[model samples]
Target: MESFADLSHFLRSHRLRTAPAETGVSTGAGPRTAPCLLPAELARAAGLDADRYADIEDGRAGRVSLSVLHALASALHLDADDRAELFRLGASPGTSRLRGLGHLTRAVPMLPVIAFNHRYDITGWNLPGQALLAWDLDWPVEHVQPNLARMLFLGRATRALYGNGNAHGQRQVAGLVGALRRAVEQHPDEELTRLVVELAAGSREFAELWARPAEERSDEDDCGVLFRFEHPAVGLMELSRVVLEEGAQNGEWAVVFSPEPGSASAAALDDLLARVSGRPC
Candidate 1:
């Protein structure tokens, strides 16, 4: 409710920013000549009844569905960042989770940090994470954030990064599926369901993993799985993977990779950091 309080203001501001021509709504002649679209015009564009839209815009709607939020975002012509913020503002109670993603990455300098919610949607990564993972920081903000399971099962770069190829990748995905199973059972989230459905449809490996019994899955090493990456920039590197839970109830966690001190992997990581920071190693 604390965050939801801002939803009205957010919607109003965006609606004000929306041009009449953008949504194809003509500015009526009764002194409404400002570039902004009227509430009724926005409601028509968003396909909601005028009263319903007014309730939502007035903070009187107790809970708005994701579908409605998506509609509003599309009608407003919001870009990715604004869309993300719209969802955050419209999120139902008990769904508010995680510190600011960028802040979390900045909290730990020189370390590669990848954080996600219960749904495993990649929220943010720091410089080291971008350098090590070859994540294109230059990508347009509208680009969808990478999902972990999707990366493991469908991404060529991620597959190539796995030192042992498919075998290692499958193991990693099995671990992810195992965690997802727990999250799905506990939360019954819509985004998580969509992710599972998408991956199962796209990747045979993910479908097979998801089909297996929980007892038969081998995700016991999820806490600290040892990963070896054949990084294009740094060659072979070994790091211990640690999952740090950010919020106990939110199912948010940060994946951190740390190398043993005085090892080749450590040197490789240092070089990566230097490259990212523009400092000589």
Candidate 2:
């Protein structure tokens, strides 16, 4: 079995293989052309000497610093949870979990909150989350397998439900892979390590992005990603995401969505829910 150390090494190697062009990092490159961002480009983006940045990714020299990690996270466009994971990996293993980490997810506000782990498996969700998705809370987590990426890519209704579906799906996939990379770095013994590798192999886009170093972002700013949804009753809806975390359990993430108040999208969501459940909107 692979240890956490082995997982970390695998993550680093996988990250290095993905490059800028693979993730649509366009700088006047033709659509057919995929360009690799050399060490200098990465160094410049991270505000480090090319050799120093290379050494860090290579695991040959230099300590992983917060500033450097932040820079890389920005360059890679990681979401909040993924960024937090990176920070955890950069810190001493014993000192990684933050105080009050899972509080937000556990707390039930008006909105729906669905929690997933680093591997994108559903762990828990609030009542609203169950209602929004029209899911039965009593179902087994494994049976639901509430993976946003998987749902978007494989679910029957996902494409119809999300406007900007392609971009939204790509971003979510990239973000999940980024988080997985950090998790592999922190806990190689994790069973999800092989699962991630197998999934990446099946996706060219994922394989490409997985080869590059990950980027990080603050949880607050990372929450909202713009998209649109199409409901059978609602027609079309504009949407955004809010991600909440619950420490470092390896598979915990919270995702929520909202439409503008009093907007058509909101009304549509209400109507759609009512129609689906035969309840008043």
Candidate 3:
């Protein structure tokens, strides 16, 4: 299956990002200090034999055990989403014990919260989020559901919310492009492919960026981005966009906006939340 190669890539990428210092894996008697963890080092950290880990990484192992997958996930310091993805790619292909936790977004009423999947489909949002983005969370019967990529590329108003034709804008667009490509790589489907084709045909900027080699593009917003939003009500406010993996196996991401404490942005956010308090989501 292609998932095997995807799993191998995912594990290798995470392993490369993890350092020996982080894992506390000793480099034996030799005075060799490599930057990233070696395959054997990762195996030792996960309490697995070197050969077993090597087989897994090389895609020679068939149907890895859950215990081993958990061990590797723990050793790799994977977050909720990464852990979920690991389990999906390693232990079980279609079986998922965790799902449908998007309601957690409503728990944080003070900040604008949006929940989306790898497909960029906006699954859930709180009233503050709806108000913050001026997005009608409740689409009409004839209207389509909200999607981040579609809004960014297709909707003029949503495009205006991001950075304009500058470095910041370029970074934002390139990040989205990288993210979309990664999403398609992980989960190949007609819908996702159709979205890419549609964007390439409709958006010249998207087409240009999408045409660029994957190695040439940088995904700077993998964790989050310092988003400067032009809120219609609060005016210009700089909020740190924090992206956390929601506790679900559906590849959901919880995107939260936080402003510096005691700043004008924070005060404006407070006022905005207060105004929307007790309102329908």
TM-score of each: 0.60, 0.48, 0.57
lDDT of each: 0.71, 0.53, 0.69
lDDT of 2 at 49: 87
Please state every model's RMSD to the true fold in angstroms: 7.3, 20.6, 16.2
lDDT of 3 by residue, 39-126 (tens): 9999999999999999989988977776788688778876434554565567343223223323344356567766666677654455
- Candidate 3 clash pair list: none
Candidate 2 — worst ten consecutive residues by lDDT sum? 135-144
Off by over 4 Å in 2: 1-110, 126-144, 154-169, 187-189, 216-221, 231-233, 246-251, 278-281
lDDT tens readout by residue for model 1, 49-127: 9999999988889778767886787789874345545655676432324545445455666677766677777655566
